[model samples]
Target: MIEFRRNIVAGTAVLVVAAVSGCAPGTGDRAQPATTATGTSMVTSPTAVPGTLVYLDVAAGRPITMTTVTDGAARRTTFGTATRSDEHVLVPSPDATRLAAVESPDPDSVAPGDLVVISAGGARHTVATKVMWGGGSAPVWMPDGQHVIAAVGGQWRVIDVANGAATPYPAGPRPGADGGYLTWSTNGHWRAIGGSTDVTVTAADGTGEVKRSVASLPECREAAGCPTSVQAVSDDGRYVALGHMNSDPSRVTEAHLVLDMRTGGLVNLPPTAPGGSVDRVFFRPDGGMVVRTVTNDGRYTFVLLRADGSTLATLPDTTQQHPSGRNLVTYRP
Candidate 1:
């Protein structure tokens, strides 16, 4: 249920993106021109933000698509068609060329399933395992990109994607001081663990010592059983993001919380106007952040943020109807 990121020494506050009513300057509410192209379009003119935005349409069983932005133009490339669903939690490899998916055949039950590894050319290799759900439970691709670390039936195992081989991984999913699973930085140098009350950021070295612990927002602390997950970690390890993932239309919970690891400051991110919650957060290699927000009606918007958590631009609506934008899973910068 908790969400996922990595480490830094000396902490400050956090950063998150939200759609505020009375949007003020530096509130990070600035919206960019939307990208409306849909279907199997090979290329688009450009997106407001420059980077590769990947979307997996699990409902359609379409190939995984990657939209790369350079200068201004945006071009898309697709991997081979593979069986994916909302029941699957997809995590890209460290090199961004492959993906590790936790696939559950039954959508209603959180049971164990096959760990599908999709190669750059779209070939899939399935490794049977009990890895269920996303966040910390999603398979973690090690720095080598060949082996993945996943928690299997309470014990952690290092899985080999090439063949269905696995070995014990004692240094398993490192939990934060508050017991939440740790999310690591892009470089694997930093790891962050967040909970309902506080978030702890630490270096990834053998020390495993708590370097900085910052308080969560008042809203998070007030809500009972307020779920928290270390979603994204800035590559520089200075900022960490905590978010909630509520797809149900009835529940409009707190959107997100961002902590500045250097200063321990928190960005004020309220929920969207129409029962929208921050579903996911991805940090660009340049320190920028991409936030995925979902509304009560099942609409999704991808927003780009500066290093300081200020709004930079927004992508097109990634609803289920759009073939190209459907199931906006994650982004790679």
Candidate 2:
């Protein structure tokens, strides 16, 4: 039921007619414009506030972006043609300093042309060497803004924002999945890879410490090996979100699992209802957990919880707080 980011990151398709070779890693301290023909008009404002939220509105023909500050101010920018909802997107850094986005060559192409780095100062720097086709997860910003973590071609790589060079992650081989796969908690020292049969947690040294079989879970189908798959990890690397294989047409429940990397404990969160299910599971920027669930009636519920699984507040609609613009705190990285 956890909709991991195959195309969860939202953005508009760039309609540039031509493709340009990217600059080298040592491209100097200046903020480089990834595309000279970037179609977006500039909206000069103070640097994006620390708690600013960046999200795309795919409802219109184009993706309209809303960036809202913590103090109740919001700016709206609409990009070109509305792109596929499934494409990868640039996640804001933990500090909100920079973002790693995918820039496309053509307006209608499904594959992204390159990885572009956008700064809070409105600078666009393209990692031209890092072309992405079939992006696995949304680009994740490391604790620092200098690097990003992404899954491309079934492999996870840490990409430098300034240069296009990619470095192999310390994690072991890529795990299997029924559909798009995204690893959670990239900033943490511990990571879990959920396979068709079991879920395995490993340390930075690639040592597997916990292995639990999910093959017989009621939410699993025989067609897909394991029912639960790993999604987002917490900033502290103590928790992981394990998504269920709900995309398959078979009779698998949409429930997902939240794993504790340190204690090796697993909490199987059942679906919210007959017609409802859990959408996203992640630890907030403040180390609290957020579970966005769709009720049986189809209303979106945002449940904020403490690190120890205690409930904080459940906002039926975050829009109540930001009356003027869309509040997106659920999209996966």
Candidate 3:
């Protein structure tokens, strides 16, 4: 599932507080020097990097729109009418040359959905498929842009853009187990499946090997207790961010973790806020950091962290309408 921002307001305020404790130094003469408070500190208006565009699904009757923020200024750009479904909006290529989105003509057509590749030059190509469910989520592009990994039917499939052919991977347990939810490592050697009974990874070659399982992780529940959910793997494939949903599917809780794919060791992330769940995870262009979100009340906060689970920065809160609904957030590398 793609992570999206819900509401976009003009501006918001973030408050930082510093704590101080009173104490006395042992001693003497009648008066002791005043001890200065040190340690905890709060920084307001932390400068954030510019040039990041967040595609938001606003409530106003339109499809989807782009919200760009540079420094502290914000602008909105209209990108034509988008698919009305809840699928994610694809991020354009690094050069903004091409964009890949999942388009469905109707709700019930067999090959209802197609991969719509749009170029900045205005050329378009529609790659239709029958192997997977047309109503599946957005398509993720490989580094070369010649291949896209998407979930169709109940399995993961890779589409060769050259000829529009799709090759399906082995099906994980469960009916309607569409691998529609997936995360691709930046190196292209590994891919992770979200919304499964167990967190599964496979080789990019369709080798069908189960590289790791979430059940074996320290905190993941077994098949009987595991909740149906989605996860995002880091660009380097070193971390997997999993979202846990309640049985009713109305609420979700997220845990950010780093797993050594080679060893299956897991590291839990420190809490970002008291309450709120993770929306999605995406690696920064440089692959040195990953971006994730924590939603509390009706507001969403974006966090940038190192691969090892250290917090780098927490962006200002942005307003959102629905906290339970899925939102897509993509990084342009």
Candidate 4:
């Protein structure tokens, strides 16, 4: 299995606690400001916004929660019992109605485990397998939403969510082939595979690859935290989000970065509010990006941003009691 480090930092400015999913509900684009508990304002609507943002609430029984833009309301739903913090949870389907996750009956083992598929109304299907689970390397949903792509014993496999059927998937390389972490876009057309020093953007079929060595950048050489893995990829494979790690091991700092595959340039999102840092960035299916921000006091907030880096809305706060305080599982938009 390809081991991965899941603790990568994401950052951006301002605050709005809301999720992004599906199409805009109303006929016209409306501008509304929702004040968060922190007294910050978030833009709730602007030009066909992606409504519905889903994420995992770890401290709360590890249940999956969905927050919508229209009312800034969140509804919590549990698929199954809680798994370890390291285990994957609530990887949403392409349609955002179903979710894919990994679980182990034997909780202490670090090896691969069974794949679980959870649909709407609390219905679930579990398929026994040895698929490795971790951040950015979790089971990925193909565009069809019925089948899932997973990494098994190092290579990729196409699994039928309806049944336990599986087949070898060679669209991407095996673990030892490049020693890089692998993450695929939901569209199944692009893959971002790389490590702390560099990242490679390529077609799903393994053609037209472009690699940039981040180790050569000033952030890797002179900054406190260096990127450790690729967190999320835009649907078109044009924008890539990176996670950073510091050498001190005692201090954690996240550098909010997005790589423009088209220009080979690195773009940083707006700065975060005082003592807050970006934790994760998930690209919405329709457009824009969902930025997960973390405060020093263990509060979590989700902000929806347009492609131009403007705030669409900010989801409300979700807190984690654990020392790690990283409760976000996945954001399905």
Candidate 5:
């Protein structure tokens, strides 16, 4: 029997209120303008543009919520429950109508875990694979919403929604290596995997085309300042965000690098060391902006930025309620 322990933070009661109110120390009252820790004010979007943003909330345990931000308000919609002890919710389609999520019933459970799907209205479907146990990782949905790609066991497999069948795809070498972190191109034509060596991109349909590769420090596990064991690919698939850190892991920062997949050119974005390293990078529906999270002592602060690496605004941390749960983000353009 494998039990997963959720870490709960103590003290800092005032910090909790400040986080939820989107006011981080010295930011004055909630009615005042939002600012970063450096006291830089941010512009708040008055209304959530209709069909413009999808907010990911892993506040709930097994069941997660996907909220649509429009007209400046949040409308949360409940998705299907997960089967994996450690699961991640993914939205790969551009229309925000389909979702892919990984599910492992037990930590010690073996092979053939499940890849579940949820339609826009929340219809559930499970795609079973031969990759048994080892636990499934993040799922990337294809643009058509009929297929999804995930790393099961040590191999990456693409599952078809119509038949709930999975086909193995070349996930770049190592069998047990952590190719778990994956993201789909906004068009859903390509999928990128981050693991032992460089980040590798491939076609989602098993077309066997090597799109491009962006090398990171060899041996990610052994890298000196690599803060994160996970990485995220932008929705457009033109950028990859890597979390850098010191030896302690607690002291971390983010390195956002824009990848010109067509030319194999990599440009590093301005470093944003927001207390903790950026845990996740998500593209807004407009494709012109992104949202990232930085965490410290189990607390998270969300930042909205432009593709050019400009800080737009900072969203209040909502992870206080579910300190142990992963924060999910999505957009509904």
Candidate 6:
């Protein structure tokens, strides 16, 4: 039993608010733990991804623990009793009932290893520990929460959580000639295959493929180098966040764009907030943008942007995000 920092937190917003497990925080970052409120007003579309909980191992130890700030307090749960710390990647199942971590015993090497699946209740299991290696790749959960997917050795495989069995997964996209990443839309209907030169979006079931080059996207190409790649897709699969980084820091600041996947339209986004550079971006179920910014000094902030690329709220003293996508969670030591 380990103690984690508070998940449920209150904070200063641009009128932003934070919460945990359906409970809202008080008025500031130091808000004390409060009794949980019952009921959730969260409405979901038929295609909405059901997020169970925001979880991962914040630290490694004998009894591996995953935590989240819930109800204005830290909530730590033991999910890894005997799991090895060398397993560098920690991914939570979409349903939050289990976790997937690389079971690599050698921390220094990026060699293949078995992948372990540990239930939130502390049940540990695996399929191919020595077959997959870490190349900055992570296990991703499908929106349905029934399967876990990973790209191994440039090939893709899907694991059925129920039986710990795996089979080849036909992820649509030729391997990038110059290294790339595979990301899923929030609803799991769209897969974004991004590389240095181009990006392709296609249906998860392998249909409706659209490919665009870095030079073709607006504000990229000759103007600001090239659109690096799409960082995140909106939950509704209507918008995507694209980024372009400047090679020469003195000449260009990082540039970002919100591309409408439905209409091929592009909207520029603000690259910086109070904290620092925007480090991460995700779309809320309602098509709002959840932007996490990190300053040069290492502090973090969560800013919410409307669908039209306007700031909805700037949450202060927030770090970790709730998996529910509605609020940001603050962690206090």
TM-score of 1: 0.62
Question: What would the per-residue lDDT of candidate 4 be over residues 1-333, giving only the tens digit for each residue?
Answer: 000011111332222211122211111232333243211222346332244544444433554443323234455555554456224344667666777877655544445677878765556687647766543456666667878877666666788898878887644343332233556675566677655677776666665566777776676775553574665676656567876642321112232677755445565554677998887777754446777777777666666775446666775443333354334444444
Backbone clash tally (model 4): 13
RMSD of each: 10.4, 14.8, 14.4, 10.3, 14.2, 12.8
lDDT of 1: 0.53
- Per-residue lDDT over 31-134 for candidate 5, one digit per residue giving the tens place of the 0 to 100 score: 22234321122244422222345555443245656665553565666665543332333443555555655444443443345666666555767775433323
Query: By the lDDT metric, which is better: model 4 or model 5?
Result: 4
The candidate scoring highest on TM-score is 4
lDDT, residue 84, candidate 4? 65
Model 6's lDDT to the true fold? 0.49
Worst 10 residues of 1 by lDDT: 1-10
lDDT of 6 by residue, 1-333 (tens): 001101112231211122211211111132222234212211222121122224344344556555554323445667755444333555666545567766665645555567777776667777555544343255666667777776555566787777867787754574343234455665566666655655666666655666655556445546544665455654334445666632321111122455544345454445674546765566654334556676667565655554334565665434243332122211111
> Model 4 misses residue 247 by how many Å?
14
- Comparing 4 and 5 on TM-score, the stronger one: 4
Worst 10 residues of 2 by lDDT: 12-21
Q: Cα miss at 91, model 1 (Å)?
A: 2.2
lDDT of 2 by residue, 4-56 (tens): 21122223121111111121111113232233322221112213222334443
The positional error of residue 270 in candidate 3, measured at the CA in angstroms, is 3.4
Reference-based lDDT, each prediction: 0.53, 0.47, 0.45, 0.55, 0.44, 0.49
Rank by lDDT (best first)? 4, 1, 6, 2, 3, 5
- CA lDDT of 88 in candidate 6? 51
Q: To one decimal, what is the Cα RMSD in angstroms of model 1 from the true structure? A: 10.4
Per-residue alpha-carbon lDDT of candidate 1 for residues 1-333, written as tens digits (9 for 90 to 100): 001111222342223322222221122322332245323111233354455554444434666664444323555656666453432466667666777876667544555667888776777778756665443355767657788877666566778888878887634235422124446666665566554455665555423333344344455455343434566665545566765522221111122666655455554442464677776667665445667676777666667665444566767453333323544444445
Q: lDDT: which is higher, 2 or 3?
A: 2
* Steric overlap count per candidate: 26, 8, 16, 13, 16, 15
